[model samples]
Target: MFCHSMTNSMGEIMKKDKLVFKSVLLTSASFAGYNIGSGFATGVEALQFFAAWGGKFAFSGIFLALLTSMAVLIAIYVIGFEQRFVKSSDVYHYFCGKYFGIVLDYYIYVSMIFVTFTMMSGAGATISQHSGLPAFAGASIMGILCFVTAHLGLERLRKALSYLCICTVLFVLFCGGYAFLTSGVSPIAGSANSEHYVSMGLMLRANTFGIQNPYLSGLSSAGLLIVSGFAWASATGSLCNSKREAVFSGIFSSLFFYMTTAVVVYLVLTSMDHVAGTEVPMLAVVHFLLPKLSVIYSIIIILAIYSTISGRLFLIAKRYDRGNKAMGFVIILSITILAIVGASLISFSKISNVVFSIMGAVGIIVCIIVLTRFIIAETMPKQLL
Candidate 1:
């Protein structure tokens, strides 16, 4: 009965059902893969939020991953709704529209395009930092690649693009491991910064490079991580269905996120001193720990960026196909312009913040509406029971 409800055939259900353990692992990795780009992969974000607070913050990151898992559950259930409601993947339209539906649809669509653009710009910046590639060139290459992928329908691209996430984990682990073996520890793991420790009785508090107050700092970081996860899961929820599936997938995905992020953060903190002040903390560590490996990892980082850009494009195209052309065209154009703006003014960390902020705003609204609708629908009886 469960299988039938999932899909018409076993094959179809298999495609939609929580992937097998291994595939789920890969999918989760892909989810995080695109989710974490230059700033994330390089520990710039971890530094600001996680590593800046020192070892104490790692636990916060783990907890945030758990929240991400919850968001994934919400997303999966939305996907199931997509299958049932519209018989299409155009999940945004169902929720956003009033009478015409185009108003909200345009908003969602534009938001998606902006997201993809920002992602591509970020990839370019990462490549510049890691590989010495021209940032514009790198961004252009990645953008074009994503454009091609978007031209294809999403159903064909989802599985293929997911591999990028898996590859990202393996590359980070391999590079970070090598750094750990050779570089040895520095200060970040439980080492108290004098500034953070000595900042008692000050008006605004003494300044520190990393965390000023460990406990409060950790909580703030955790909030950012969970907020980031929520934005991502809510935006992608249309692809998943079933509360059980959403919850399970979220748990699985968050586990990978926290584990991998912890290792990378640790590696960065131990090998590179003064990284907290740098624009690219992870790159500083890589450049210090193993220059040769940094080159290789740089390529992988570019690919990771591409993977996310591709996913965003595919989603936009899919959503556009289901809606009015006027709004759809506007969305695509606005996203293109937004990407260019981000490319000009933003770096990896800032772009990530924008992406997460947009996702957070859109996601919370969508989640409330969808969950409420689902509950109401399920409770209604033959005569409004």
Candidate 2:
């Protein structure tokens, strides 16, 4: 009898552990998918923020920046779990006061729409570059797809994002790792061609919002991530079964996010000669390394773009839909139409460079507020929220 009872207890414990592990992975993948938009998928964001600094600064700078971003993400998750927020935007109100939080909320709301536009542009750029299809065709396809997935609601969206995130990360790691290993040029070694070396000053000027200082750049990047991803992160946190799950998800997701970034940065640095002046640097590198995979890589980029836009559009539609199915459909359709039109007109690089910088600057302010709140919460004897 005693032996049988012990066996039952052990089995239960194992089952519980398995469930927690599964939950952590799903949460981590969903969070990663939410953040991996066009800029990240194409390596443009990494190139501008990290690799552009040359091999020496790229690793250290990206690590620091991603660390800061990771901390911010963890804090948001913890707070979200504790509060159990109904509306995701309320996270801004919690970090900032009611008035300022309201302002930031609206700002982020509009910014999310703009980010969707950027994703549309990225989709168009990826397709046009790869297959010579009209940019609008790609944009329209992405917009429609995102709308459909998002309309499926949160439960379905979460599962879809998780699976897509896994596939995308695996693809990136394989390509980046393969490129770095196969490329004869060492990443740390400065480029032999002085003409190809992009000076820090020139890179800073060309990037517009690019911060030459690694620390500041990291903060800005963290800020941008926190601001743009606040809704999804907070929502994901609320779904956690316990604080342990939230923390685990945050740590795993953060490490995975930065690890993939480091690989891409290394790949870009080694292949700077080939990727320079290209709109999609990662695609260019993949083409140079494995020409056969370029077309497949293009589809992967679109899938990544789809994952991100679905989350953004879901949040936007949910906020305005207010439980009305017809209203939600109309909202998604209108946004898709507007995004497709905007993407058709604007260049992907311009939107990524100029608009993202401005958003990152705004995001910095939000990050400060979140950090301050987190510090205070930790110091207090009682839970503030």
Candidate 3:
């Protein structure tokens, strides 16, 4: 009897451990999936932000960006733990108070819509570039799929996104590693072949945000991610079984994001001369290094875009959902239509550059406020009693 009881206790302990591990992975993958949208999967975002700097600056910039962004992510996850049962919009209210939170909440709504439009445009661009299909067809297909997935609500969205995120990260890692190993050329070496190389100075000058400093660029990058990922992070946090799981998920997710980003930046740097002018730098790298896998990579890009689109759309629907099933459907359908139409008019590159930069500026302010609040909360005396 004593032996049987001990064995049962061990089994229960093992099961709990497995459960915690699974939660951490799901939360981590969902966070990664939300951030790895069109810009990230395509390598365009890294090209503009990190690879553009080149040399040590590129790596250092990415490191700084990850550091700051990870700090913010951890805080967001903790808030999720505290307010797990609250509505998604309540996160903003908690961080900024009722009035300012209200403003931030509405701003996030607009930002999420714009990001959805950008992802729609990205999907169209990827398909058109690879298969010569009409951009509208690609955008329409993605928009419809997003509507369906998001309508299923958070439980389904998280599982689908977690799987998609794992696939994307693995593919990117494989392709990047394969390309780098076979190229036999250092990333810095590509910079020497300056046929179409745009210097960092020129690139920064062309940026809409007027951010000349690489460090500032890092901050802006972190800001962009923090703001765009706020809703999903809060939702993921609420799903955590414990504070340990939430914190672990945040750290692991941030590290995974940084690692994949750095790999893409490395790959782009290795072929900067060729990918510099291309619409999709990662696709360009794949075509150069592994032409046979271009189709596969394109599919992955669409999936990555799909993951982000669904997450953003879910947040939008959840904002007004309030247990009204039909209303949620209407909101998602209307937004999808608007996104598809808007994406049709603008080029993907133009939308990515202008819209993301503007949002990044807003994101920076949001990060500062959140960080400040976190600092004060930690530093203040526990009690005046």
- Tens-digit lDDT track for model 2 on 203-261? 32113245446556656666667777888888889998998888787777777677777
Give the CA lDDT, 0 to 100, for residue 1 in model 3.
Answer: 100
* lDDT, residue 102, model 2: 89
**In model 1, which regions exceed 4 Å deviation?**
1-19, 71-75, 78-111, 131-134, 186-247, 272-274, 321-334, 351-385
Error of 1 at 62 (Å): 3.0
lDDT of each: 0.55, 0.80, 0.83
* The 10-residue segment with the lowest total lDDT in model 1: 201-210
The number of the candidate with the highest lDDT is 3
In candidate 2, stretches whose alpha carbon ends up further than 4 angstroms from where it belongs are 1-7, 190-211, 383-385
lDDT by residue for model 3 (1-385), tens? 9999999999999999999999888888888888898989988788777787675567787898888888888888877886674677788887898999999999999999998998999999898888888889889999988888887678888888889989999999998779767888776776554324664322321153675566777777888888888888888888888888888877887888888999998888888777766677889888888899999999999999998999898888889888788998899999999999988888887788787788777888899899887677667885821
User: Alpha carbon lDDT of residue 206, candidate 3?
Assistant: 15
lDDT of 3: 0.83
